[model samples]
Target: MAKQKTAFVCSDCGSDYVKWQGQCGDCHAWNTLKEIRLGPAKGSGRAGASVADQRKGFAGALDSARVLKEIDLDAVPRISSGAGEFDRVLGGGLVSGSAILIGGNPGAGKSTLLLQTMCHLAKSMDALYVTGEESLQQIAMRAKRLGLPTDALRLMAETNVEAIVAAVDELKPRVLVIDSIQVVHTDELTSAPGSVSQVRECAAYLIRYAKQSGTVLLLVGHVTKDGSLAGPKVLEHMIDCSILLEGSEDARFRILRGQKNRFGAVNELGVFAMTEQGMREVKNPSAIFLDRGSEPASGSAVMVVWEGTRPLLVEVQALVDDSQLGNPRRVAVGLEQNRLAMLLAILHRHGGLQVGDQDVFANVVGGVKVLETSADLALLLAIVSSFRDRVLPTDLVVFGEVGLSGEIRPVPNGQERLSEAVKHGFKWAIVPKGNAPRADIKGMRVTAVAKLSEALAALE
Candidate 1:
């Protein structure tokens, strides 16, 4: 006979926890202990309900455990998102039987991208969008705003997983899109919608159906006040791919960032600017973010911020002014605060700049929040330029990091950054001290900057 069945669940990883504790042994999320259900000890747990588990007792009796078996490695035909930025972020688009969990703050355009993608697929394949978060009339209004085709796209507003699956069985959709999975619950789970148990149960059923039937499932998830996925942590592990739609509250630009991809690259980002018609693709982002027609102004410099494999040239602006009060202020936006402090010290000591008694304010134009340390050189140069009240050359781009000793550090894939700059019509590139150009892109002059002093001298 099977052991007693229990609903032990971990507050941290959502892994079943039979006993209570101060900390979650798995995943190490502190203070994340909760007894989701009453269950017996681990030895009395019921067997997992799968065919694979039934073979547990036949391992030795079965023909020699196949040590090495041929496996299928080739990827299936993929569906590309109409937007290049979006497609690249999803590692060249959606794979068959993939359950993608996308979580973001309110107004992050999660629904916009998902619906548009479904509409795009509905043109060729059968697609069904089940929205537990929005009513049919609401979705129709939004579809009208999106200029969607009435016949190709199908919508069902349901919150029950059993009913949703039945509709899927009837529709036999090639692609299924669920907007805000937190709203959908299961009949088996007594927990309410958006709760830990409900989200966990609903996600498990959808994931199981997708894997068994090879249907591409797209899920829109919610974010808690702390900006984490609103469901149990295990919900993230159950999905094959996870993306976070991040941006401002007003939604000027949206960043589609991938956290986990069974088939593609990680940390890939796609930038999209919100418009009246819909989310518009920014083909030439550098031109829009970086000032093109501006004269070389001191206290401003351009940088090649690496977003995954792609290099984007962004403008870094710094302002250094004499501290009117005894204590100076340090302010940075779209940049790390700790690194700014380090760079300031470097400028004051190694570069012989008098910034200690001055207030500094730094920003990356166009609302881009860059995390690359490669922005170091540009930041330092911008500080110097701002102090000198001069601007950098309008035709130039800066690429490199700054060391404590005031030496220029080379960034990864410098060649890619250079080519992108050249394609964007940048003429002069101030790179690391000893870096060599990978290819001579015509119309662009490369300048090797060894130190903070050397770069300032060249600009002067």
Candidate 2:
């Protein structure tokens, strides 16, 4: 007989501890340690029984490896779903035998996007959608409401992992979509579905099946409150690609960002707009993110930021007001709080703006998040414009990284940013001194500044 033991596991990092604690030692997440009862050790009498049950639907055998030169390069061709933005994020199209994990907040349109993709792909290739969360009738209703044809598509509503795998083996679909990996369970595991062990094991079986059968597998996952994919962190590492569908709940715009991709580039983003028909690709995101034909208002500035291979012009807005409370508040949306604080300090020390005692709030328009430092200068300028109550030129676009000593640092792809700005009818641009255009951009003027003070003076 094997001895059973209790272990405390951190939900964020999957690190197991001997005792329960308030904070996870590895991930530093507070109140995340959950106590779980472990079964007997591996290799015990029950081990073989559980392992054999879990391996029932998994494909068997491993082929011998071949030399790099002898391997065929064109065995697998990428499959296109006819969605431009979606294909762009995938680095062309979906690859055979590749496992993709996409997670997002509830109602962020994960199911809607996947269903649309399945509908499109079903027209050309054999596509199967297995929904554990919703029934076939519900899915059909949604498809009908979205005006999608369900003739070529096959839908199965099953939550048992083993049954789903059996169906996949029998059907042999070119593309398979699991509505959510969290809702599926296997009888081999005593733990419930969505548990760390069950999620990890179930995904392993499905991924193995995909590899052996050359089927493209798309796994939809749930996300935690912190906007990270739920389940064990190992779940992310087990897949070929990890994608995040990001957008505000009330906003129509959705950003499909690739966090990890084995066959393509990482950090690539595809912009989409949720419409009455379905999710529509935004070919020109600049026009959506930037407000045009309005008078230039205080605390508003245009910034040219790069998302993957594309450059977008978005408006950054800030507000500075007298603090009625004892401690002044620093609020930021679509921008990091720490980053905003650092920029405010640089503004006061370098740009000679006093705003520490006042309440500061900043946001990026169109529900877009600014993660890069290229928007630092524009954010500072917006805050400065609000503090001074001065209106900046509506046609001006600014982009550069602001350093601790108030130096404006050059950003990558300076020429591309300027070109994008010019295309959007921006007449003037403020860039880092060293970031001169490789070629002259037509219909635009470039004013390079090395210091934050120079950038602020350019507003005069």
Top lDDT hit: 2
Q: How far off is residue 6 in model 2, in Å?
A: 8.6
290-354: candidate 1 lDDT, tens digit per residue: 76443555677788888866788888889888889889999999999999999889987778887
Model 1: lowest-lDDT 10 consecutive positions? 53-62
Error of 1 at 438 (Å): 5.6
Residue 148 deviation, candidate 1, in Å?
Answer: 1.3
Clash pairs (backbone) in predicted model 2: none
Model 2 misses residue 284 by how many Å? 1.1
Per-residue lDDT for 117-171 in model 2, tens only? 9999999889999999898999999999999988999999998888998999898
